[model samples]
Target: MLEVDGLTCRFGTKAAVDNASFSIEPGRFVGVIGRSGAGKSTLLRMINRLETPTSGRILFEGVDVTALQGRDLRRWRARSAMIFQQFNLVGRLDVLTNVLMGRLAGVPLWRSLIQHWPQNDKAVAISALEQFDMMPMAAQRADQLSGGQQQRVAIARAIVQQPDIILADEPIASLDPRNTRIVMDALLRINKHFGITVICNLHSLDLARTYCDRLIGMSAGRIVFDGAPAALTDSIARELYDLEAGEVMDDAPDFVPGELTPAFGNVAA
Candidate 1:
């Protein structure tokens, strides 16, 4: 569903991502693990055409994504969407309205500005929220919802778009244990039930192990490891994260997903 080849990104003189290449098949789940500045975020951004790659190719379902621009880029972006760590949403808009924004690409800007969507769009947004048990809070303002609710709203927004692929960057960085589990379960359910291809970048190796079918490890802007969870060990984690002896404890917390909490309850990223 997604293919990347010889991808590179440079900031001034420093290359943040170097010649990265990978492909994601439909219904496949892959976890991205790497040290900070390992190019994980850059890779995801390039896939969605949100960041301009300094060099290389990005193809989704056969079209060259790097060459897409204007309307082509807009359509492709809607097809391959992203979920960010920030859970970007209008704080004052109601939850349902936030989800409805997913249909922006299809709706006229004037109609969207009026918030007078067609009845079918409303139905689609409501059903998407229902998948995450978010229908009850649809009328609540985005800021009025808890953090977990907000993330669910975000996921619902993604679902409403009916994207063929979902790219999530550090999706679990802020939630508590329960909220994390809820969000992860939701993503897994979406991937399994809807067969949407998923590529997620996660900081927690244990979470990657628990939920991902394959792992892609990175360091210094290049992929160094790609395999199953059992293939990644303490030594491997150290290598991917650029850690030295005793840098990470033996009993590091396993990344079990928990329910997302309110932003006030969000732990430090």
Candidate 2:
């Protein structure tokens, strides 16, 4: 459903993403794993056109996404929704209203400016919230929700967009273990039940293996490994993170990097 060819993004003397190329099939749940500065975020932003590539061809459904302009680009972005790590919602706005913002891409500017969504649009947004069991909080201000609740709200907004694909950039990086599971489960359900293609950037190897059907590992802005979660070897994972086997284990109470034994073993506590 999506293909990236020889994608490159440079900033002055540095290249954030260097000739990265990959493709994702429809309804596939894929995970991008890498250490910091591995260009995972830059790669997703480029697909969303938030970051223009220095050189590359991004094709979606056989069309050249990189060549689009203005309304076309806007329309393309609407088809590929983005879920940011920070839960980028209007803090003061009510939860339902924030989700309705997803419709702004298709709605008239006057209606959006006035926050006057038609009943159908409101129903769509509400139904999205209901999917995540967030309807009870619809009247609450976005800022009043907890981190996990806010992330669910963000997912609701993405769902209301009726996107073909969801690009999640480190969606659970800032959450507690409990909240992390909630957000991950939500994404997994969306991909499995709704069949929406989901490409998530994940720091937790265990989480990636648990939720994603395929895993793509990056090193220094390039894809180093692409395969099923069970096929990811310890050596390859260490190489992707530029870490040695001895340094891969985490001693934190909530995480046991040591437990990551055997193929597709639990990567975190």
Candidate 3:
């Protein structure tokens, strides 16, 4: 389980996240919903310590990951895998090789640099690919695969890490309907099959309602509503999105408006 307690992140005078608190249990699939700049991504980043919080405690299985530094921090991050929106795979590397890289934290850096993945890592990577039915593309370069395939490969990498929690940030933002289903399907399977806690940052309520066991709504840097999908009323969405009655939309198809380019660049939190 993941416990985020009184989390706060400050950038200069403004707090990107303000005393945010939430807990997720194992095998639970939860969604974080908010308009851009609601501090959703910052909160996720803090989970793995990519961004440090100004004040707060984040306990991962009773260990305060927020207080760790150096080696301890690295270990905590490895325990919780992060899936980026851009599918942060090395395009030049083969899918299998990239997936095996997840074991690098445990392997000696010198050995990893020499591409000498241990036998166990190789078997683990292969098994992860088989789980995703991505074995056929294992030898292919990451750049050669489709967007959905790359995302699966990324998940396979996470699988090999044996993460207790998976943090996905707008994972389907760049995909079409079919690809979106493909990625979300894999995520749901991972959560159910492996009992890994999943906290996904989502743009579409449809996807959230379909896959999440619970949904968390955020606005102006705080979680305004946190509950089951059935409990998400229209008024909650309006308050979350700052929309008028008629203009309010629920579960619209995920879209990436070109103007929101560099999404959340000048995020006001």
Candidate 4:
């Protein structure tokens, strides 16, 4: 279990994440939903230690995550992989090599510098690519792949990290509708199939309702709601988004509970 006790981040006088607190059990698929600047990204970054917190504690299995340093911090990061909105792959590197980068923390420094990956690591990278149906593009440059394909490659890289949890920050924000379904499905599969905990920041209420087992709603850097998706009533949603009912409906016209957008095409192979 992961415990976030009164976590907070302040930039000068402004608090980006203000006294946020939550707990996540292993293998749970969670969505953090809020409007822009609500500090959803900051919360995830703080958990990953990409952003330093001003107060409170983050504990993982009885260990204080906030106090970790140097090698320990690096090891913690290795265990908790992060996926970003923009697919952050090396543009010039081959797909396989990019995935193999996940193993850098565990490998000897000289071996990684020389690109001398162990056979077992190679096999793991290949297996991750195959799982995402990107094995055929293993030798292709990351920049050459389509947005959807690149995101898939990014996910494959995360998988090869063998992370206990994945922190996805608006992962599908830039993808087309078709690719959104594909990437979201891939995340769902990773959670259910491999039992990896997934904490995702999402802008689309439809997608959050459809994919997440639990939802954490934020407004102006504060956590306002936390419950199962079904419990998130229309009125609560309006408060979370700080919008009128009509505006909420206008934003999510196709939001049928437990269903993805019907217009999305099949997953690309």
Candidate 4, residues 1-269, lDDT tens digits: the string is 99999999999999999998999999999999988899999999999999999999999999999999999999899888999999899999999999999898889999998999999999999999987788999999999999999998898888888999999999998898767777888888788878999999998876888889999998888999999999998788887887543443344334323233332223231
For each candidate, the alpha-carbon lDDT, in order, equals 0.82, 0.86, 0.83, 0.87
Write down the TM-score of every candidate: 0.91, 0.91, 0.90, 0.92
User: How big is the positional error of residue 28 in model 1, measured in Å on the Cα after superposition?
Assistant: 0.9
Task: Supply candidate 3's per-residue lDDT for 44.
Answer: 93
Judging by lDDT, tell me the better candidate of 1 and 2: 2
Q: Which is superior by TM-score, 1 or 3?
A: 1
* Weakest 10 consecutive residues of candidate 2 by summed lDDT: 260-269
For residues 1-269, what per-residue lDDT tens digits would candidate 1 score against the true structure? 67889999899998888899888778887899876678899889988888899999998778898999898888888887788888998999999999999998889999999999999999999999876788888989999887877888998898888899888888877887667777877787777778888899987777788888999988888989989888988787876776632432232245543323342222222
Order of candidates by TM-score, top first? 4, 2, 1, 3
**lDDT of candidate 2 over 8-50, digit per residue (tens):** 9999989999999899999999999888889999999999999
User: Which scores higher on lDDT, 1 or 4?
Assistant: 4
Count clashing residue pairs in model 2.
0
C-alpha root-mean-square deviation, each candidate:
4.8, 5.4, 7.8, 3.4
lDDT of 3 at 247: 35
What C-alpha lDDT, on a 0 to 100 scale, does residue 219 get in candidate 4?
A: 87
